[model samples]
Target: MRLSKLFKNAPTVNITGLCLDSRKVKKGDMYFCLPGMTFDGHDFIPQAIEKGAIAIVHSKDIIDKLPGVIYIQVEDVTACMNQCARLFYSKPSDKMTMYGITGTNGKSSCANIIKYIRDLKEPCGYIGTIAIEYGKVRIAPDLTTPDTLFLQRKLSDMVRAGMKSCALEVSSHGLSQHRVDGIRFDVAIFTNLTYDHLDFHGTIENYFEAKSILFKELVKEDGVSILNIDDDRYEDLKECSKARVVSYGIDQNCDYRAINIHENAKSTSFDLVYKGQKYPVKTSLVARYNVYNLLACIAALHETGMSLPVILQSCTKIPQIDGRMEQIECGQPFHVVVDFAHTPDGMEQMLRYGRQVAADKGRVITVFGSAGKRDIAKRKVFGELADKYADLIILTEDDPRDENPKDIANQIKEGIQNKPNLFVEDRYEAIRQAIDNASKGDVVLILGKGDEPFMYHESGRVPWTGDNICALECLKASGYGENNNS
Candidate 1:
């Protein structure tokens, strides 16, 4: 593409490539100088040019101008880069129906569910925490929300692969960084804003305001915003949105609401009440929290012009959302679940479900730990929630990245000190202990680090089997499974 396609009134130059990181700048590539939280991209301009970046796009003023290189200064570097990427990629998101889902939790499950429903009608692409999937392409995500250039490239790939729609999980960090700005989303879904990522936003209000950017700034004025009216931030997000608002929840006068919910060991059934008509839904999804995810998915599909009956029909065959209440069966007498419930709101709901699933004479055993350099406030709260609903609590390692693992566990132990709990530093051993201690009919809940393949540590990217896999291995080693050799 011509450089002029990116910057108006600039010289027409053939751009070979685009780059955000100067280290990755190739010869003849156009490099974008971004002002970031930690490092200033402007400082790397000479290095980018040194590495043969012929064109420089920057938001700040250039102190020293180099001859023979194109310098286009914009008001916002990230926004300008986003626009350029959109143009360079031929605006792939516009070619397809784009749905963006945001929240502290459930973004992955919601996005995945929407993709599954859309796939029943037509091929749909998905980009989120677990993985990026479209037309047999599966990539382990480096970030929950990839960079603008990478995101546009994937959407372009999806469009080329004959996908008519895409379900994308929009993260608060992505919103604040202007990563998803140029895409014209057809529907924006807000699951719920809870107390997560406060370390990044500093305050709950700031975190909320960051989440609000998607509805208020990104979604088209003619597009629709789907919100959970049962959430505390519903009023704020609804009021902030310029688009038409559609609400969904279990307890609210919503455009889509679930009623008469029923759950068995195998599945959950709920009636989706919209307007005056009701659609029955039954899926393997368990827990009240997932009911909210379903409502949001149904509402998004409706706004996307999918027939309500077809969507409800699709809901009945909902695929198990991996790591979000994913069950691990190995012929154990008790039940075991692996989940990505790392926040207070998420853990509370998962534990409540755990309490319900435990047999009358069984126990609800939970094993989880907080991460390093995150919202420390939630650590003790996690302990308290486990104390309330779990019969035994086992604290273990979870990305204690530069911080001491024992210290992280102690912070969580502060609240449940008087309760039945064990501090186990090694994550694998903790899982083994939890499984080994489980009696007949007991329920084991493993929280945090869901299906993540790597554990974040100070050493960086340590290989680790995922929570679900580890739990499965431990269950097999416990000598109860029919397939076990032990």
Candidate 2:
């Protein structure tokens, strides 16, 4: 591409690519000097030039200019980068149907379901916590939402592969940083917002504003804004969004509502009330939270022009979402569920479900931990929820990166003032002990790290076998083999 096309008053040099990091700059690449909290990109100009970056885009004035390099000054490099990336990639999002989901939790599961439903009629891609995938390609994501340049490029690839739609998970950080600035969304879904990521956003209000960017700024004029009215933040979001609203929830008169809900150890059944009628819905997914996830997803699908019946049928065969209440049946007499409920609200809802699963016959044994350097205030809340919900609380390491695992566990323990709990430093050992102590009909709930493949510690992330596999192995060791139990 020509440099003149991306920026004004720039040299007509041929730009081969774009990059943000100086270390990754290649020959003919245009490196954008983006100032960040940790490191300023301007300081790395020499390195970027050395790494064959021919063009430099920065907001600050360069005191010492290097020869043979084209310099382009901008008022805002991040915004310019987003626009340039979109233009460079032919604005792929504009060429395809775009659906966005944002919240503290359920973003991944909702995105996956919307992608699956849309893909039924035409090819649709999915990008979120699990992985980015379209057709035969799947790439692990480094962030909830990738950098603007990488995201545009991926969407371009999806367009090239003939994908008709894309379901994306929008994060508050990504929105605040304008990562998805140039991309347009046709449908936006807001799952419930909870107390999480306070370390970054500083306050819940600021975080809510960041999430509001999607509905307030990104959704197209004619697009649909879907919200779970059951969520406490619904009124705030509804007031923020100018676009038409489509609501989904229970105990309220929503556009898409679920009523007559019932759940058991196997599945959940609900009557979905929409369009002045009620449709019987049954699914393998149990718990009220999942019903909320379902309502939000179906609303998006319906707004995207999918038939309600088809979407309901797809519900019957809902794909197993990784780490979101994923069950491990190793022929154990007791039940085991692994979930990615890291937030206080998420943990509370999941533990309630665990309690339901436990019923009168057993107890809910919970094993989870808090992340290092993330949110310190929420650890105690985790303990409080666990104490109220679980019978035995085994607090273990979740991702105590650069923070003492014992310290994190202790903070959580502070909340369990009267609960019978123990701090197990090693998570695998914690899982082993929890399973070893479980009796018949007990529901062992593994929280926090779901299907994640790595464990974070002071040494950073290392390869991990994940909780489901560890539970299966532990159950096998306890003489509960699938073959034998079946």
lDDT of each: 0.90, 0.90
C-alpha RMSD for every candidate:
1.6, 1.2
Model 1 residue 146 distance off true place after TM-score fit, in angstroms: 1.2
Per-residue lDDT for 353-409 in model 1, tens only?
988888899899999999999999999899888888889999999999999999999
Q: Give candidate 2's error at residue 287 in angstroms.
A: 1.1
Q: lDDT tens digits, residues 1-486, model 2?
A: 998888777778899999999999999999999999999999999999999999998999898998899998889999889999999899999899999899999999899988887888999999888899999998877788989998999999999999999999999999999999989999888998889899999999999999999999755767889998988999988998878999999989989999999998778999999889989999878788889999998888888788999999889888778888899887887889898899998999889888887857798898999999999999888988988989899988888889998988888888897779998988899999999989887999999988888888777789888898898899888888847753
Least accurate stretch of 10 residues (summed lDDT) in model 1?
Answer: 477-486
Error of 2 at 239 (Å): 1.8
Model 1 pairs whose backbones collide = none
**Candidate 2, TM-score vs. the true structure?**
0.98
Model 1 shows how many backbone clashes?
0
**Model 1 CA deviation exceeding 4 Å by range:** 218-221, 482-486
